[model samples]
Target: MIAPLRSKKIIVTRENAGGKIFSKKISQYGGIPIEVPLLRIDCDDRDENRRIMKQLDHFDWFIFTSANGVEYFFKLANKHQISHEILNAKNIAVVGEKTNQKLKKYGYSADFVPTVYDANTLSKEFLAKFQNPGEILLIRGNLSRDVLPSELKKANLSFTSLYVYKTTINFKSKNLLNEILQREFDFITFTSPSTIDAYFELSGYLVDKPCVCIGTTTENKAREKGFSTILTPKVFTVDAMIDIIIDYINKKEHI
Candidate 1:
């Protein structure tokens, strides 16, 4: 039997390394993956970031919202020679399994992870368990949403946000994105709001192809950007998004 994604050309708009992984997954299903990395991720090495790292012991809990957050946080921590013992002393909370796994790479594990991977669910469930939690530290990227912090504020919880990384548009990908869009593509996958914004800015228009978003947050951004056909998986993961795309193609083929 032919694969569900056989002969389909899917556009991958994730960052560099992530795009390669997504492309590999697409290739496994007989799909042609066009990598058009729209966003670039960089670790923040400012003095302020290091200053915040030095105060890590002051916080009661450390929350990581994305894998990038965990990766860059540890990168900066290691660059500044922050001891693992110091980080291991605090409680860790992550938004998703990927983030938790990233945290584990630094010899730590999450003390709290919500059943759902989205920020909204993380905030809701996190607040349910730790009503009177003390000073918390949020490790995140510059483009991170205010959902978690806003919830903490409403509950009168003290938290300090430390931006460990920043995601910006890959200006070098503009010509490539234009060239790729001119070709026939079956689907476009968006993993974050930054990717969506970068695509729109670089391309100056939205494609009519079916858009696959990793979660509701990205789906909402796609909708806001005027994408008509949007597909989102229940589980917010790249693997789950690929599964959703295969299922979507299989159903469409039957019809």
Candidate 2:
């Protein structure tokens, strides 16, 4: 049987590690993956991170909003020679499968994860399960949404939000820029709203092209930027995004 994404060229705009994973998935489905990374993740505010780490045991719960958060958090841990036992007292929660998988790499697993991979849904799911207010530590990136903390506050829960990593725009390579100008990409995938912004900033315009977004926030951002043929999976994960792409391709071919 022919591959669902045969001859389709999908542009992946995630950062280095994320882009590679996304590109591999695209190739697995017979799509030509274009590695046009739009952002780079960096560990920032080392002193602040160390301060937060010192108090890691005080929090009742530890939450990670993305894989970068998990990665940088562990980096700080290893740098400071902090024991894994520091996190033993707190219940852990991660926002998505990627973050969950990253947590697993550190010999840890989330105690909670939302069905939908957005801050609003994570807040609702967490609130529904644990109604009592307590000290919560949120490890996230600089560009993270306020929805999670805002919802937690509305519920009378106190939390400390830390930026474990910062995301900055990746300078588009000349070849990639030329590819965008010359090639006809079948779909452009944005993993976050930041990626969408960086992509448009680098490319100078949003083309009238089909787009796949990982979650509602990115999808909404694409729409705000005048993307008409935007698609988002019911579940916000990279695997889900590829599945939705295949389904879209199959539907188009059938029509």
Candidate 3:
């Protein structure tokens, strides 16, 4: 029997390491995986990150918007030799299951995870539980949306934004860009708005092929960039996105 993604070429636009994982997932179903990392995540070196690490006990909640935030925050924390005991009394909230998993990797787990995995939904759910908002620390990337911070501000809640990482375009060899553009790809996967923006920056056009987005935020960003066909999984996870893509491919093949 033919595999679901047989003869299909899928473009992966995650960072260097993440793109490899997505590529491997695509290959499992017989798809030709193309690694075209559009963006790279770098940890911030500003003293503000260290300041936030020191005041972990002062903040009522520590919110993480993405896995990058969790990874970079802990990385800087370890570099500064900050003790994890400071976070013992603080509540941790994560935007998605992936972010939660990243937190768990450091021997910690999220106290609050919204039913839906986006800033808008997270703000709503978090506000419903803790009306006061109090002093909060938000560790996120530079490209993160202002939905949560803006919502908190409107509600007169006090919070500090601790940018832990920045996403920059990873446009390397011109040959790679040309290779990606010249290939006939069946689909492309976008994990964040930065990836979508970086892809457009490199390609100078919207994706003509179908796109599979990890969540509504990425799908919305793609739509705003003039991508006509964007698919999103009900559950905002890479595994769920792959399942949706395989299902879509099987259905299309049958038709």
TM-score of each: 0.97, 0.95, 0.94
Give the per-residue lDDT of model 1 (tens digit) for 92-149.
8999998998888878899999999989999999999989889999989999999998
User: Given candidate 1, what's the lDDT at residue 240?
Assistant: 94
Supply the global lDDT for candidate 1.
Answer: 0.91
Evaluate all candidate structures by whole-model CA lDDT and list the values in order. Answer: 0.91, 0.86, 0.86
Ranked candidates (TM-score, high to low): 1, 2, 3
* Global Cα lDDT for candidate 3: 0.86
Candidate 3's C-alpha runs over 4 A off are: none
Identify the candidate with maximal TM-score.
1
Per-residue lDDT of model 3, residues 137-176, tens digit only = 9999888899998999888999999998988898783358
Residue pairs in collision within model 2? none
lDDT score, candidate 2? 0.86
lDDT at 161 for candidate 2? 89
Candidate 2 per-residue lDDT over residues 1-255, each given as its tens digit: 788788698888888888898899888888899887789888876688889888887899998998889999888788878798777777999888878999999888899999887788889999999997479999998999999888988998889988888988888553585577577888889999998888777777768779899989999999999999998999988999999999998898799
